[model samples]
Each structure stands twice: as structure tokens, then as C-alpha cells.
Target: MKIAVVGCTHAGTAAVKNMAELYPEAKITVYERNDNVSFLSCGIALYVGGVVKDANGLFYSSPSELQEMGVNMKMKHEVTNIDTEGKKIAVRNLETNEEFEDTFDKLVMTTGSWPIIPNLEGIDLNNVVLCKNYQHANHIIEKAKQAKKIAVIGAGYIGAELVEAFEVYGKEVTFIDSADRILNKYLDPEFTNLMETEFENRGVKLALNQAVTKFVGREGSVEKVVTTEGEYEADLVILC
Candidate 1:
């Protein structure tokens, strides 16, 4: 049997590694758009907080490592289209922009969630980014070095943790969320209130119950965030 796997993040990496070990007799192929794989995006905040000194430590697996396990690892390749009935997929080499077809007896999709980018004014300005991948994490860290004030949209785990990191790094942080409290989907008011208080104590401004209407910029860079309630200055913005 021949198996083709698309994506090599948390899910894809686990699937491919387990399959290669369990089904050694079967031919396995892995496709990853990134040059590296198995990055723990959850550790991004830790990296930003200076707990993790090296960004290379974020990745758990590499293309060569997968190849050593007798799996065909195709890095920088994107599976553009999959024909389920024909058991074939159209693969594109991102580096050379070349396209080709590959047949497989079975196919697995481990494509992860994408960061939702809201349509708003000045959204494409410099220093406005989304945090979801290894590259994004690195970009955030590099850009944050010069950012005096940082704003994070979405009060999820990633956003909350990121604000904490920025606060620890001595940057003024503003966390904006449409919800009434941070991590409302995961924690109760009692617990969330404690976290909110802690954030406030650390000088992290909470902009809860406010929906970001648009971004105001100057000199091709985001300078402030406008919401339903008010506007806050931000040299860098991250959408979590």
C-alpha cells in the first residue's frame, strides 16, 4: 500500500511518523509546504518571553529525519488539489513553481486551522500580522524588538499568553476582544477575573467587549487600533 499525507504539522507529523513505524511494509510519502515540520506553535509565547532562547528548538521533526525513517518527505511542496475518486493529487513545488501529479492508494489530510483575517481598513499595513506558524512567530519576535506598544486582537489562549510575554518584555500591550472577558470560551468568570486582574497588575490593558472596526496607520504602518468603544496606540499588531 502507498500512502500520501498532506501537511506536516502536529497532526500530520504524528500520523506520518506512526504510520511509518507501524506499517513499515507500506510506502509512505509526506508533503509539507514549510521547509521544517512539527513546530510547537503553543511554545511561541514562551519563546517570546525569553524562556526559549533558540527558535530552532521549536521544531520537533525535520524533513531529513522523516526521510531516515524510510518515508518520502517532500518539503516546500503544496498539494493544490486532491482527486478522491482517482486517488491522485496535484502537487506544486513552491520554490520552482512547478506542478506535477502523484497517485496514492490512500490519502490523509492534516491541514490545520488558518488565522482569520478580518476585512478592515489599513489591514495590510506593516507590523500587522497573524500568529499561527513558525514563520509568523519568528516575524513577531523580530518586529517586537522595536515595538514600544503592541496590540493583540482575539483574547484566546494564544493572544492572552502573547500579551503576557509582551508585558514581561516591557512593551505596552493592549488586548482587544469582542467578548466580555479573556478566555471566556474556556474559563469561568471567577478564574478569568483573576487573570484579568493579573494582567492589569502587569500593565496590560484589556479592551474587552469592543470589536475592532478598523486599523489606523501612518507611514505605511499601523499606528492605532480603532474599536467600537475607543482607539489605542499600537506600534505592532498581532491577530491571534
Candidate 2:
């Protein structure tokens, strides 16, 4: 049987690797838009804080490794559409823009979570970004070069770690959250309290329960972060 896999993150990478080893006779094809695969986005903060100096430490697997295991690895390839009726997928080479159709007896989709896009005034301005991939992490560092005050939105895993990293990098940071506390979805109030205290002790601004009304900017760049409470100056804005 022939199998086609879309995406090559945690889920897709595992599926393709297991299938190729378990069923060597069965043909397998893996499509990934990124040049690299199986990146541990969770470790980005460590990378940023200099805890992990090697950028390769963030990647879990490579396309060449999969190819060596008898899997047909197609990097920089993006699937445009799926023809479920015909058991084929329409795909394009992102680098070449060449389109092609591939047939398969089975299909597996492991598309991961997407970064949320918040609609706010001046959000489209420069230096506003999301920390989701390698490119994003690199962009964050690049933008920090000219920024004095950085504002990070959301209080999830990425947000918390990003703020911590910024503080370590000597960048004045203020974390904004709409909820009453940080990590409300995961940790209880008591544990969250410990974390809050740590951030506060480190001189990181924990702006909680403050709903952002808009992003005020000038010259197409972020100038201030406006919320229900007041406006805070920000040279760079990030969402995670």
C-alpha cells in the first residue's frame, strides 16, 4: 500500500517513521513545507535564554534522516488540496511553484496548531510577531535589536517563557493577559502565584486582567499598547 503524509511535525513525523520501519515493502511519501522537520518549538525559550546554544538542539529530526530510512521525503512541498474521491493530493513545490498530483492508498494529516491572530489597531505595524517556529524566534531576536521596551501578549507556555527570555536578554518587558491570572488553563491559582512572584521579583511587569483595546503606533511601528486600564509604551509587540 502507498501512503501520503501531510505535514512533518510531531504527529506526522512519527507516523511516517513508524510506517516506513514497520512496513518496509509499503511505499511512503512525506510532504513538509519547512526545510527542517520535527522542531521542538517548546524549547524555543531555552534557545533564546542561551540555555541551549546549538540551534540544532531544537530539531528532533531531519529529512535526510527519514530518506535514509526508505521514506520518500519531499521538503518545501505544500499540499494545495485533497481529492478524497480519487485518493490523490494536489501539491506544489513552494520554491519552484511547480504543481503535481500524487496518488496514494492512504492519507494522514498531522497539521499542528496555528498561532492566533488578534484583531487590534496597529497590530499590522512592524515588529509585531508570533513565536511559533524557527523563523519567528530569529525574527524576535532581530527585532529586539532596535527595541527598548517589549510587550508580550497571552500567558500560555510560549508567552511566559518568552517574557522570561526577554528579561534574561536585558529587554524591559511587560506581559499582558486578559484573565485574572497566568496559565489559568493549566495551573491553579496557587502555583500561578509562585510564578507571578518570580516574574515580579525579576522586575517583569505582569499586567493581568487588563483587556487590550488597541495597539497605538506611529510611522507604521508600535508606539504604545492601549488597554482598558491605560496605555503602555512598547517598541516591539509579540503574541504567542
Candidate 3:
């Protein structure tokens, strides 16, 4: 049997590992757009905060390890088109820009999501970043080092964690969210209120219930965030 898996994140990694072990005689191939695989994105905040000394530890699996299990690991390869009727897929090697075709008896798609980028003025300015994946984590860490004021544009788990991490790093952090409270989807008011209080005590600014309208920048670098409620100074902005 021949199997082709698209993407190599958590789900794709698990599928390939289990299949390679269970069906030892079967031929399996995994295609990932990224060079690395199985990155623990949840640890991004810890990594940015300097808690995780080694960024390599964030990845649970690699292409080398997957290849050792008798599975073909094609990193930096994107599946451009899939023909279900013919059981064929068109692939492009990102590194060499080489195009090829492959046949598969079975296909698995674990393609993940991308961050929602809002349409706002000055958004394309330098120092504005996103929190997701391994590359994003590294970028955030590097930017955070030079940033004096950091603004996070979300109140969810990752956003809150990043806010706390920036606070610990002594960077003036402003937490902005459309909702009235942080972690409203996951925690109750009482819990969120307590967290709010703690953040306030630690000098973390909370700009809740406000929608971001524009990003004001200076000389191609982000300077301030303009929201529905108020404007806050931010040298770096993280869109969670």
C-alpha cells in the first residue's frame, strides 16, 4: 500500500509515525512546506520569555527521525494539486522550484491554519509580528529583545501568555482585545478578573473591549496602536 500525507505538524506526525509502525510493509511519504516538523507551538511563549534555552527542543520530531522509520520525508515540498480520481498529486520542491508528480493509494491532509491578519493601516510596517509556528516564535523572540514597548492584540491563551512573558522581560506590555475580559472563552469572569488584577499590579496595561483600528508607525517601524477606545505606544506588536 502507498500513502501520502500532506503537512507534518502534530496530526501529520502522529499519523505517519503510527502508520510506519503498524504497516511496516507499506510505503508512506510525507510532504511538508516547512523544513522542520512536529513543533510544539504552545511553548512559543516560554521560548520568547527565555524560559526555553534551546529552540530546537520545541520540535518533537524531525525529518531525519521520520526518515529512519522507513518513511519518505519530503521537507520544503508543497502539494500544489491533488487528483482524487486518478490518485495523483502535483508537488513542487520549494528549495529547487522543481515540480513533480506522485501517485498514492491513500491521502491524508493535516494542513494547519494561518494567523488571521487584519486589514489595518500601517500593518505591513516592520516590528509587527504574528505568534504561530517555529519561525514565528524565533522572530518574536528576536524582536522582543530590541523592543521597549510590546503590544499584543489578543486576549486568548497565547496572547495572555505572551503578555505575561513580555512583562517578565521588563518590556512595557499593553494587552488589547475586543472582548471585555481576557480568556473569556476559557475562564469565568471571576478568574479573568483575578488575572486582570494581577496584570495591573505588575504594571501590565489592559486595553480590553476595544477593537484595533489602525497601526501607526514611524519611519517604517511600528510606533503606536490606534484602537476604538484609545491609542497606546508600542515599539513592537504581536498579532495573536
Candidate 4:
């Protein structure tokens, strides 16, 4: 039996490993857009905040390990199109810019979520990053060290955690949200208020009830964040 997996994130890694163990005679192939797999994205803020000393610790699995387990790990390969009827797939090798096709008796799709980029002015500027993946985490940590004012757009779990991380690193952080309260959907008002108070007490600026209209940049780097309410100076902008 032959099996092909589309992604190599949490579900994909688990599926591929378990399948490789359960079906030793099966030929298992895994395609991953990234070179590394089993990255703990949730620990990005901790990494940026200096809590995680080594970035290598963030990855729980490696390609060599998978290969040793009799799994063909095709790193930096993207499954562009899938032909379910023919049991074939079109893949592109991102590193080599080569395209090819492969066949499988069984297919598994674990393509994960992507960060939604909004159409806003000055969004193409430098130091504006999306909080996802290991590459983005490394970029954020590298840039955060040189940033004085950091503005995070979105008050979700990731954004809130990033704000706390930046604060601990002694950088001024502004938390912007379109909702009336932070974590409105995740937590009740009472808990939200309590966390908000904690944030404020820790010298983190909360910009609630405001929607980001656009970003303002100068010399190819973000300088200010314009919102429905007002403008805030930010050397680095993170969209969570």
C-alpha cells in the first residue's frame, strides 16, 4: 500500500508517524512546504520573550528522523493540485522550483491554516509580520530585539500573548482590537476585564473598540498604526 500526506504539521506528523508504525509494509510519503515539521507554533511568544532559550527546541520532529522510520519525507514540497479520481497529485519543489507528479493509493490532507492578510495601506513595509510558522517566529524574535514600540493588531490569544512577551522584554506594546474587550469570544467579560487590568498594570497599552484602518510607514519600515480611534507610533507591527 502507498499513502501520501499533504502537510507535515501537528495532525499530519502524528498521522504519518502512527501510520508508518502501524503499517510497516506500506510506502508512506509526506509532503511539507516547510523544511522542518512538528513545530510548536504556540510557543512562539515564549521564544520571542527569551523564555525559550534555543529556537531548535521548538521543533519536535525532523526530516531525518522520519526518513529513518521508513517514511519518505519530501521537505519543501507543496501539493498544488490533487487528482482524486486518478489518485495522483501535482507537487512543486519550492527550493528547486521544480514541478512533478506523484501517485498514491491513499491520500491524507492536513493542510493547515494560514494567516489572513488584510488589504491595508503600508502593509508591505518591513518589520510587519504574521505570527505563524517557525520562520515567522525567528523573524519576530530577531526584529523584536531592535524594536522599541511594538503594535499587535488583533486581541486574540496569540496577540495577547505577544503583548505580554514584548512587555517582559522591556518593549512598549500596544494591543489593538476591533471588539469592545480583549478575548471577548474566548473568555467572559469578567475575566477579560481582569486580564485587561493586568495588562494595563503591567504598562501595556490596550486599544480596544478600534479597528485598524491602515499602517503608516517611512523608509520601508512601519512607523505608525492608524486606527478608527487614533494613531499610535509603532516601530514593529504584528498581525496575529
190-236 per-residue lDDT for model 1 (tens digits): 99999999999989999999999999998899999999999999999
Candidate RMSDs in order: 0.9, 1.2, 1.0, 1.0
| Every candidate's lDDT | 0.93, 0.90, 0.95, 0.93
Model 3, runs deviating above 4 Å? none
- With a 3 Å backbone cut-off (N, CA, C), the pairs that clash in candidate 4 are none
lDDT of 3 by residue, 143-190 (tens): 988899999999999999999999998999999999999999999998
- Weakest lDDT window of 10 consecutive positions for candidate 4: 55-64
- Arranged by lDDT with the best first, the candidates are 3, 1, 4, 2
Residues 49-162 of candidate 4 have per-residue lDDT tens digits of 889999888988888989999999999999999999999999999999999999999999999899999999888999999999889998998898899999998898889889
C-alpha lDDT of residue 137 in model 4: 92
- How many backbone clashes can be found in candidate 4? 0
For each candidate in turn, the TM-score is 0.98, 0.96, 0.97, 0.97
Better of 2 and 3 by lDDT: 3
**CA lDDT, candidate 3, residue 121:** 94
